[model samples]
Target: MRLSRYFLPVTKETPADAQIVSHKLMLRAGLVRQTAAGIYAWLPLGLKVLTRIEQIVREEQDRAGAIELLMPTIQSADLWRQSGRYDAYGPEMLRILDRHQREMLYGPTNEEMITLLFKDGARSYRDLPRTLYHIQWKFRDEVRPRFGVMRGREFLMKDAYSFDLDEEGLKQSYEAMFVAYLRTFARMGLQAVPVRAPTGPIGGNLSHEFHILADTGESALFYDAAIDEVTREELLSADASTITRLTDLYAMEEEEHAKVETCPVPAERLRTRRGIEVGHIFAFGTKYSASMGLSVQTKEGGQVHPHMGSYGIGVSRLMGAIIEASHDENGIIWPESVAPFQVGLINMRADDAGCAEAADRLYERLREAGIETLYDDRDERGGAKFATMDVIGLPWQLIVGPKGLEKGVVELKNRATGEREELSVESALARLVG
Candidate 1:
């Protein structure tokens, strides 16, 4: 996309309200704007990154056999009442009333709604094991919403509900989601460690919170060093015995940690790091199902409540968490999978005829090759242009100036490595496209 045509309203001055680096950069880059205290309107550039992240999450969910279906942002309060959570959910639940004075609410989670839906249609045991997921906006009235999207009151989340006929079936469903979460974060260039977490309001005895370590993170986590090397494919392909072996690896949140004489790793490798909770999985057996009368007939002709599990990923919060985990002094070093654009083309002399010609040709070449290229063809000074491009931190950058154009050579720079090479336009194109 051409910079002149794009709506990226980048600014040099950082906003005083932004306390964190990700929040500050997001504002400076014109990625998002505050619509309310904790609500934001995602700008074009921000939306592009969000969409990319969502696609990766969707793909991973689909791979795990979870079907996607959207639920409503607003839900009937009667559903929560049926689940006996209307009064228990506390202030985080945004209770509301319609014009006719009927009780309503903006759903913070879909346990109650999903349970009612499952109970209504799924009567027999034929649909015993089914997983339904949705990527949608959620609202929670945070008393103090801070750190941009990291703790926003209104944000996007991908929540999935799994229904199984029995306890054993529920375990299998949980395992599938656990493996899917690992692959989803890995594909986004994040190493998320699964740690046992508090159930909180989403009451469940079995729960795991996937955390990405960052200094600015909110939660303190402890885990064995070996978890870093474990891959999703390894876990997914493992047998029941292997699954037990892998799951036995020591990992827990600070709340669950109890000092022991024997630890899994040596003292040096016993790492305790502050991390942001990116995703969470829960197995709440018969919690909502029993309360909402979500029961199915057994083969023996007895009514039984289906076991349920809910998995959630903080979709919008991940944008901030990723920036916190993967940025330098320059700006965001976006992972290629979630980058707004794959490459940034800098024409040092946008007004100059020769430089413009070379940049235009390179831009077309990259676009035709299926590369997402952002051409910085604005008439700015070379230093300013370089600084801007570096701040945005595209993986690859092509610099075409008057001198380089005259010599039929352009400079190519890899943003991550800070490596630069002078090559002919054809050579650069081949190197990038190939």
Candidate 2:
């Protein structure tokens, strides 16, 4: 994508309304624009990052044997009434009325709706163990929505529903989702720790919230420092024997902490830090299924309520949370996995014939190699172009100038590491394309 032809409306001055680092950087980088108090219109760059994150989440869910399906943004209120949550859900539910005066809602979650769907078609235990997921937008009317997308009124969410025949079967479904969440965050270059959390309105005795530690995070979390070094491969890449071994690690929220005298590590090894909740999993046995009449016939020819679980990942909130965890003082240093573009080609002398020729050739070479390259073909000052490229935070930057064009050399700089090297045009192209 050529920068001159792109719609990247970057700003040098920080907007006064943005209070947090991610919020401010998002605006300055031209990733998003506020259309309302908490609602935002994701610009081209922001949509690219959001799509990448969604793909990662989808792949991980597929690997865990979860089937994908899309659900609608609007739902009938009759389903919520069947589950006895019509009035219990409170004002955040965003209740509405159609022209016919029928009650409807922009679903905040899909527990009741999914339950009704399951009850209608699934009749026998043969379809007992099924995991269904959808990536869709959700609306929750927060009275005071703030923190950019982190606490927005409307956002994208990846919610999965699992069904099982019995308590033992439910455990397997829960474990699968637990492993899936770990793999999802790991693929995004984030270390998310699973901590026991209150079910809240979701209503489940067993729940876990995956949090990524950041200074600007909303929740204060406590965990063993050993969790920081534990990888998803360490937990999920082993046999059933190893599952017990990895699950023994001490990790929980402050509410679940015990005051036992014996400690696994030492008091010093315990780390309490602020973190943002990225994903949550809950196993609510017979809660919605029973109320909604979602029953399946067992081997004994008896009808029983199917145990269920719901898993959620705040898809849009992750965009902000990732920026919070990854950005530097200058701008966002995007991980290669979620970067909008792999390289930024800055034509230091866009008006100069030699510099333009060199940059154009490099840009074509990078694109032909299947790299996402953004060529700055604008006739802007060298310093301004470089600063904008840095603030945009492309993984690599290639500079073409008149002096370098004469020597058949270009400057390559790594965004993560502040290392700059002058190399032949061929070498620079190889570094970027290879």
Give the per-residue lDDT digits (tens) of candidate 2, residues 1-434. Answer: 99899999999999998889999999999999999878999999999999999999999889888999888889999888888889999999899999999999999999987887778779898987999999999999999998899989999999999999988988899888888887788777787877777899999798888898899998776677877767657644534443344356666655566554565757888888888999999999999988887889998999999999999999999999899998888898888989999999999987788778878988888888898998999989999998888888889988888887777688999998979999997788777766
Give lDDT tens digits, candidate 1, residues 175-281: 88887887788787787877777788888799988898898888877777777667656644544554465467777777667655566667666778889999999
| TM-score of predicted structure 1 | 0.95
- Models 1 onward score TM values of 0.95, 0.95
Q: Where does candidate 2 have its weakest 10-residue lDDT segment?
A: 238-247
Misplaced by over 4 Å in model 1 are: 231-246, 258-266
Q: What lDDT score goes with residue 366 in model 2? A: 86
Residue 298 lDDT, candidate 1, scale 0-100: 85
lDDT per model vs. reference: 0.87, 0.86
How much does candidate 2 score in TM-score? 0.95
RMSD of each: 2.0, 2.0
Model 2 residue pairs with clashes: none
Looking at model 2, residue 285 earns an lDDT score of: 90
